[model samples]
Target: MQYDSISHFLRTGQEHLAKGPVALIFAEDDVEINTTLRHHLDLGFSKVVLFSPAAFNIAPELAEKCPRVTLESPRGEPMFDAVNAINDAAIGVWLYYCFNSEYLLYPFCESRTVGEMLTFHTEERRDAMLTYVIDLYATDLETNPNAVSLDSALMDRTGYYALARNDPDNHNHPKERQLNFYGGLRWRFEEHIPADKRKIDRISIFRAKEGLKLRPDFTFSDEEYNTYASPWHNNLTAAVCSFRTAKALKFNPGSTFQIQQFKWHNSVGFDWHSRQLLDLGLMEPGQWF
Candidate 1:
């Protein structure tokens, strides 16, 4: 189970700093971290780092299964701090993906390596990253049953821009409105925002270049290529940048950069982050589900 050790490193650590062509970072909360760690290790990423905000609850023998893995104490802003530390090291092409345990479906959706996907984008287009969507299910259900082939399921289609118009009616039906109204006035007010106004599907992939800094403002825009979004609202407006970006923006580990209140367990963060990336024109809609 040496691979289990590697899998643990990938799932629960931070970003892999070991010298390599690529480094994979998995920021996870609660769930069996080893499952995700093992999943990504099979995806061809040799160096992996896992970051967790809670104490390791697995049995001592199971926890010790991953020797090379580095465990860091949980902090208030573990995600931001871990990412910053990894980017500071400036390893080769950094591909960052964050999701809850429920989102990752294996043998992974595609049989392709992360490096292979990035190769599709030229060096000049490094800022343009690939995006994908996770079909959330209450049980073990799939939205697309025809997804027997990873090629058909995971291919990067064209015309997938992030910040486009969305159907408000589709998102806010009478049932949704009723739930919000019954909940409180604040919930109703939150529902009043337009669907297109909310950013949803995007991911960040790039090589950390010199002088690049993560916008300390942490908020991002829904407009194409607008990297200046603030992270204070309920929207997914934070920017994922290199350690250099964190340093430039003067981001402290304990400081709160993005603030919003929502039910954390139901995949709202992933949905919001994806939308923000699309709205800012940093990602294409077709890349996502």
Candidate 2:
């Protein structure tokens, strides 16, 4: 099933949006789109809404399960606008959003479902979960020219670091429990990434509320929702292993020639396991044990 516009879909796509933990996928490219869709479906996303200009040709198998909304020049609106459009229905519901080439990873994600993770997170009295956007790319541009490979994806194991987050309210005092995270592809290829885009931390998982809005910088309008945890203590965190940046770098006509090779000394074959992300401190395991 498909809709010509977001408004129509929001009005009639009740089957998909009726439940919670909706996965909003903005399909910019068809690379592994079927697999990405199937991944979220497998993880228990009650609704999977895909917004794309061109139809993902490989998604016929799951077409009935997911609805593809035709977006004219989808890039015109920031992703948050789409989320906010359905903000009314999303209130008090678990919401997760990401692009085509990114995958959500939680502690012990391989063995658990996203619904389970959210259930546990909600039990701990948390409204949002901070996730590190760990960059993923193909080691061999020859074997994987697109810089994306579901089977043999490679990621940096030891380049992550964080500095005190400068608070907009008060520069003298940094935001409590938050940091300006850095490293991975953005750190190595700083020339391509912008200063405002360098931070890899995102609160991708959150419980939506009335008037809630996701800012362009990956934070939320509600200040507490943007915090790393509750005012008193730390909460569990997750990871988003993304190939979005890598795929963009390799596909962009300008960057393609400049980055003929992506492999360097720090490059290592990603184990494709959650343990690697946890071991590197990219994700926190607070109260998950």
Candidate 1's displacement at residue 214, Å, is: 3.7
Could you give candidate 1's per-residue lDDT for residues 74-149 as a string of tens digits? Answer: 2225444444445555645454544323222211125555544444333234343423333221111143221112
Scored by lDDT, model 2 comes in at 0.80
Q: Report the C-alpha lDDT of model 2 over 1-289, residue by residue, as the tens digit.
A: 8888888887887667667888888777777777778877887888777887754574567888888887655443646678777666667888888887788878887888788888888988888989999888987898899999877788887777889877767966887767778888888887888799888899888887898887888888887787777766677888888898898888878788899877788877877677887888777777776
RMSD of each: 14.5, 1.7
Q: Tell me each candidate's TM-score.
A: 0.44, 0.94
Give candidate 1's TM-score: 0.44
Which residue pairs show backbone clashes in model 2?
none
Off by over 4 Å in 2: none
Show model 1 residue runs off by greater than 4 Å.
Answer: 1-16, 19-28, 57-76, 102-109, 128-135, 140-198, 215-289
Question: Which lDDT values do the candidates have, in the order given?
Answer: 0.33, 0.80
- Model 2 is weakest, by summed lDDT over 10 consecutive residues, at 71-80
